[model samples]
Target: MPKMGFKKLFFFKPSPPPLSVSNNTFSDSLMEENIETARSVITECESQSPPLFTNTRQQAKQYLHAVITLQSTMQYLVERDSSSQKLVKAQFLMQIAMKRLQTEFYRILAENRDCLDPESVSGISSTDHQSSVSDYDDDFPEDDFQFAGDSFSTVAMADLKAIAECMVSAGYSKECVKIYILTRKSIVDEALYHLGVERFSFSQLQKMEWEVLETKIKYWLNAVRVATGTLFPGERALCDFIFGSPEKKIAESCFAEICREGAMSLFGFPENVAKCKKTSEKMFRTLDLYEAISDNWQHIESIFSFESTTSIRSQAVASQVRLGEAVRTMLMDFESAIQKESSKIPVPGGGIHPLTRYVMNYIAFLADYSNALADIVADWPKNPLPESYFQSPDRDGNNRSPEVVERFAWLILVLLCKLDAKAELYKDVALSYLFLANNMQYVVVKVRNSNLGFLLGDDWLTKHEAKVKEYVSKYERFGWSKVLALLPENPPAEMAMEQAKAIFQSFNAAVEETCRAQSSWVVSDPKLRDEIKVWIASKLVQRYWEYYEKYRGGLESVIRFSPDKLGNYLYEIVLFRAEESGSVSSHSASPPHRFKRS
Candidate 1:
């Protein structure tokens, strides 16, 4: 067996008798007395029916100390008399005590497995330096390892650390380490099994159906969270507490070997998922996987810090890269779907198109993961858009990163461009304008209400708001231009009453036709819709009312609407509530007609 270093003898600090010995004879007598006391302690523990640790912890500590003291005396005898029978007897006693201590160590670990489980150990503060074996008392006091309370886990961990230090110190490290590795490894493996982590080949994952694969990805997400946040760290702490003293490499080496297989299986799943078929719906799940890995990366690096576990670290990083590629590719496909939208059918009532709804919904969902996406697409270049096209560069209070801001801006621009193409399918120029306004309003509202507003910034919202207003203005101008044309430019100094009647009759027919034709047109944004109605009333109603009053004496018999009735007509027709209200008949509700015989 390889020699266990002297540094492992944590409790073997022996101070000699403080009193001055008169001669070598007196000192020799003192040494023999100390050896006799140690031999007595060892013999009593061996003769007992119960194990030393289980019977009484103080006795266990005494037996350990006695064994260590015997080993030291044997070394002294070897130097003094290389062939002494006394040396043989001391060696025999030392081996017998070591064998007993080894059995006690194994029993403590096996019997207290639950006490040392990961979830319980993880609750112990990492900053609690008092819990380390370095603080152990040489005399093994009852309260030496008790802090908050004499908790079961606290005592068990303390006992494990004390035995580990003693066994390593006695040069029986090989046996002690073997028992520890086997027992702790079982716990780690079982914990991973309950977490639902399973190793899979690339072909198996790639060939699996998405429904099955998605369930596995969900399991992986939860597993990665618990494993990194609790399980792995707790195991690492336990290993360090047991074997970290005077040799940190042992802790790192044991930890690397113990957690290696489980961690690789845990992290390797994402890379295989990223390699599977890419779909629009799968993008968020892939991002979820990426975010999970990204979130726990710091703890992963610390837990598997050993050079031997470098492959696990590399596998995690590779999964991130591949997941990133998957997201980027899905984004490209979404953009392509927008560009490839071949529908020539104009949406009825000039309402929101399906393409508009799908793209906006997709983009809004993507906005929720803007920060994670910023890292994924850090190297993926943005589609080149004109500087003037997307002008919200200043994100002072914005939480989203610039790359994601620009990326979302480009995607929205693509959707708008697609909507612009679909608008051309409308035969009515006025309805086309209303189509643009409705879809633009939908996009602006989606951005304003979701995380996209914070990412795109107020400037982007203001720009799109301006576009919606422009569409509303064009729709009003084209839609009601003919009706407005029916009114005279000025109040005429008319001579004949017949011409005056003709003007009033033409005005009445034109207003009714305009209201009836536009009753079917739709505006989805309530605020914008009401604004359009008010603007139209201000322009058309006030002008037409003045014309009606001027011609009332000659044309009142033909007059069909009063100014108040005209305003109500505009409201009902614009809202398409004329049929619901049963008020679409010719203006029978107008005030009494007054025609003067001039």
Candidate 2:
């Protein structure tokens, strides 16, 4: 009953006309009319004559009004629940509006170019003129933001074409290039941000959104080229943005594309390689993250593993071709420089002719290649080989193949060589090569005997023991001298003792393991077992005597070789007991006194 008052009745009255009702139609019709008004303004601006207004203020006001009206219409469209068709229509209308505004402004500016010099423009006192110019400069085409759904295609295409024409007409190619690059950057940033928000996986992105992003990037790069006669500055930044951004999902998808097609090759850009190298160097500086660079390199290696039939094979071939070209260039320069040096000085061995030097250099190059191949094999992911995957071809290509097992052994040898080189003031490279003799033996055994059972049999074990003993003897002869020479001239006695102790411990472990394994054959064959026992005894005796000589009766005697001596002593004690009990011949015992009383 109280609601029957005038205040309550006011709510029942008809509402005032909406600002959109100027056309006196339904909401939809009113919207259509507003859109038409916007379209007309655009058409008028597009068709307007150059210098339509002699006054700078008038020209400024015209540019300002056009920009504001276009912006307002864009907002209206964005708020409306338009269908795909309507959205497309709205986008097209906005595109036309933008084109008209830009064309008229440029035309007017060109005509009044002499009058609107920077200094003269700066001297203008009207705040409205300054404000209008500011707004004009501030206005970015709504074509970037206004398009909805299917409308994006039509608007985007039209805007691109118009931008291309504008750049061509303005003769501001450099400025256009910069704008294009910045625009591309912005688009990429936006895409990456959205991708992060969506939390898409790499595979998901590749199947779903990769093409869309790629299309946008391609358009941007093309626009840059069309706008500018030269490539964008810091061209590598684009590569980094794609490959090294924190939006991992997008970057990973981009990586897949890059892997499928050599990204640099696809883009026809070497700047990407420079970018990779730079990023790799930065990663390398942080020891903890060095593996990141290695991971990327490994990824590169995986891409190179293409069969002859796959599409990626072509990209691999291209990468190799580029590498080969670079190597050829380097070799040419090296040979030329060496020839110059040889020409100036009478070299040893008949001046070591250029061809001979080249041959030697090529040999060295092969050695380096072998070393690098070994490293790559070592670092490859460890998984059981797929049934159909082909093995890597060896340098000789004689049915011999690269295998990680042998590569691991070679890596150990390389590490030993590096340690030796630094440990000794001057390393004998021959000794380093000898250190790898064990690895070479393993490789030979692997090649000749593919059966794992045969490789681990008695004959293989015997050969392994012999090879190890040979290396041990060689190490013993020169190791102490090398260690002493490498140490500071007056190193502390404790330091020397520590070094000697470590060496003895390592050698003792190797000898003891070999001896113990060899002893296991005792129950199988008497004659073969006796031979093995003797060999084991001889090694143990040699190592024991070496330890005693170094340590005398000290901490080294007590702690350094205790385990080795105990093992040898136990063996001797068993042999004596067997002889005394008539369980074995005295001939098995060299001499009881040979064992020092522990």
TM-score per prediction, in order, is: 0.84, 0.24
lDDT of each: 0.76, 0.34
Clashes of each: 0, 0
lDDT score for candidate 1 against the true structure: 0.76
Estimate, for each residue in 1-598, the C-alpha lDDT of model 2 and write its tens digit: 1323322322222322223223333755655655666556655655666532233334434544544444555456567654423345545655454434334433333333333222222211111111112333223343433222233332232233333333333232333233333334433333333322223333443353433533333343343232111111111222222222222233233323322322333222211221222211121111111122223343334333334214443443343334333333343344344334322221111111223223332322222233233333344454343222222333453322245333323332333333333323324432332333333333334323433212123443454446545653553344333322332333344446667665556655554443343222122223322443455455445545545554544454535445455555435533211112222222221211111111
Candidate 1 segments whose C-alpha is farther than 4 A from its true place? 1-43, 77-95, 123-150, 392-400, 553-557, 573-598
The CA lDDT at 507 in model 1 is: 77
